[model samples]
Target: MRTVVFDLDGTLVDTSGDLIAAGNACFRDMGLGDLLDPARDQKTAVRGARAMLRLGLERAGQLDDAVVDAQFQPLLDHYARAISTHTTLYPGAMAAVDALTADGYRVAICTNKPLGLTQQLLTALGIDGRFHAVLGADSTPTPKPHAGHLIATVQAAGGDMARCLLVGDTETDAKTAAAAGVPAVLVTFGPAGADMAALRPAALLDHFDDLPAVVRNLIG
Candidate 1:
């Protein structure tokens, strides 16, 4: 059976609102103006928490490393406190996961989010037990776009590297799969914006239900 590795943020869930709220909280705490414009802020959400903090700090002209770090923890803490408040699975996400699981495909998560937070969000969303394994940014020595995490996930899932597939909504996921010698599918509904089209994934999916069909087409 082929192993399917998923990225948590954009691929599985629409987390931009929560991330923007966290970022805005951080900015507000520092007495800066709001930086949560959905059109502008959603793009940065795909880049991970540090990038989000940097964007907010840069916008506020407070990009000093110390200030960034100081704001980072609090923002993440706020996000954690409100993780499920505004987050939801994208359309068909749960169905797709259930379908994949019932089909005997090993499903796992390979995400850039911190380990504890990843677990918290997954559990809060009620999908934590669906994955055979969950690999977070800190779970490996290096995170996505580095290949180690993907390789480790495949191993944990008892899958053949050549038969494994990575599904995500960002360039980092594409790069990670490429480095690991696995094919990747890029979803169109994430925070990646135009960058998703440029990644040239093995396949592009506009809906989660299209995933199983894409996999069948690829492997068959």
Candidate 2:
């Protein structure tokens, strides 16, 4: 069977607004000015919450590990409360996932988001049942940019790495796929910085609807 793995944050979901709100809330609680610019920081949100927090806190000179950790619970609380308040699947994300799953592809998620929150968001968005497996950063000993999680995901889906494809919007995802020996398709609409053309993915997709055709071409 073929397998397709997806990145959660920017690739599938437009979660930047919620993330920025959370960061702004954290800064507000600490009496610091907002340090995140949604336009500039949107891409960074795909790196996961810690990275977002680090970026904002560093700019405000408040990124001490202890202080950041101390603020973790509150930040999460704020985020959880507003999780879907500003989040939505990118255009065509749900349809693409559904079509891929219906076409007998084992669709799964491999994101750097924490397990609990990832599950929560997936469930909230009513897409939790779509994936055959979901691997969060905290779900394994190592996260993306490390092959363990991807390897584990492929194994769990009962598919060989050679028959699997990783879909994401970051260099980390490209590197992870390379390390895991799985071909990757980079999505241009996600949080990538350098031109995706430069990353030289197995394929580059501009829209979610383009996925099935790309996969067919890959596995044909």
Candidate 3:
């Protein structure tokens, strides 16, 4: 069975704007007052909340692991309240999904984002039903970079792992696919798009408009 699994944050949607805002809220509570700039820190935002908090706290000369842990939930709280305000699906993302599905491929989302938040964001974006299955960090005992996450996601989507492709925008995603012995297709339009080449994914995708051909080449 052919399957395509996607990473949520930077691969499927540009959630950096809202993610940065949530990190900034935590910084403000620390009296740091928006230490991370939205435009300049989109890469860190895509890395996740702890990375954003670390960047801001380090910038303010207040880097501390304990502090980051303490503020994590609050940042998540702020994120949940306005998760979709600035989040957007990458251009032609869903259409690519439709094309793949129509060609008899099953699609799933395997992301490091928490399960609840993944549901929230997908539902808010009104694209939850586009996927056959959605698995997040909490869905498995081991997340990305571990073969289990990809294997479990494939099982959940009712597709065999033998003919699978993983699409993402980060090294972790590439590593996950490698561990699962599947091809990794990294998107090249995110903040660190240029740097993705270093990860040595099976393919580099510049735009979703070209995904169907790319997936056909790689998966078919």
Candidate 4:
């Protein structure tokens, strides 16, 4: 079946709020008191935990790889405690998923988030069963930007790589699709939405309401 692979943090859901909070929690642990702003640092948040840590450390004049490495686990712990606190589904997200599923397409999540945390977020959001497969950075030996990650996710979802496209919101996702020789339909609904055009994805999605049609145009 034709398949749609989605990037979790910035694509399907607005997870930036919770993600930024977790980054701030790490700073708070250092007695720094929330170095990252939940609103202004959203793009960095979706970039991943390390990105947030880097930004905070830079702001605090303490950008050190060792410090960031040390705080990684604590960040995850704090995130797990409040993973769903400010996270939310983007407008028409699930409705779009249901639309694709109903139209006989296979849908799956391929996120750079750790597998355990990805599971926690999806479960907390009550969306764990929505996809045929939910692969994270640790799910396989390789992650996004590597074709293996997307191909492996397609295999896990019982999808043919030749008949798939990615719905995502970052250049990482664009690179993943490019490396895998597939179309990338990037979403324009977050802090960096306008910037997605520079990545030159097969299509730019302004809203989930336009996704099913975009997918069809790209791969079907």
Best by lDDT: 3
lDDT of 4 by residue, 1-220 (tens): 8999999988889999988888888898898888998778888999998999999999999999999999999999999999998899899999999999999999999999999999999999898899999999999898998999999999999999989999898989999999999999988897679899999889999989999889888888
Q: Tell me which of candidates 1 and 4 scores higher on lDDT.
A: 4
TM-score of each: 0.95, 0.93, 0.98, 0.98
Model 1 spans > 4 angstroms off: none
Clash pairs (backbone) in predicted model 3: none
Can you rank all candidates by lDDT, best first?
3, 4, 2, 1
**Model 3 misplaced stretches (Cα beyond 4 Å):** none
lDDT of 2 by residue, 1-220 (tens): 7899988887899898898888789888889878888878887776666777788889987678888778777878888888988898989998998998888888889988888899999989988888889988888999998999998887777767878889888888899999998888998887673567799999998988888999888864
Worst 10 residues of 1 by lDDT: 33-42
Query: What is the Cα-based lDDT of residue 127 in candidate 1?
Result: 82
Error of 3 at 157 (Å): 0.2
Question: What lDDT is reached at residue 197 by model 4?
Answer: 94
Model 1, CA-based lDDT: 0.85
**TM-score, model 1 to reference:** 0.95
Candidate 2 deviant stretches above 4 angstroms: none
Candidate models: Cα lDDT each: 0.85, 0.85, 0.92, 0.92
Model 3 lDDT per residue over 1-220, tens place: 8999999999999999999999988888877898888889988998898999899999999999999999989999999999999999999999999999999999999998999999999999999898999999999999998999999999999998988999999988888999999999999998779889999888999999898898889878
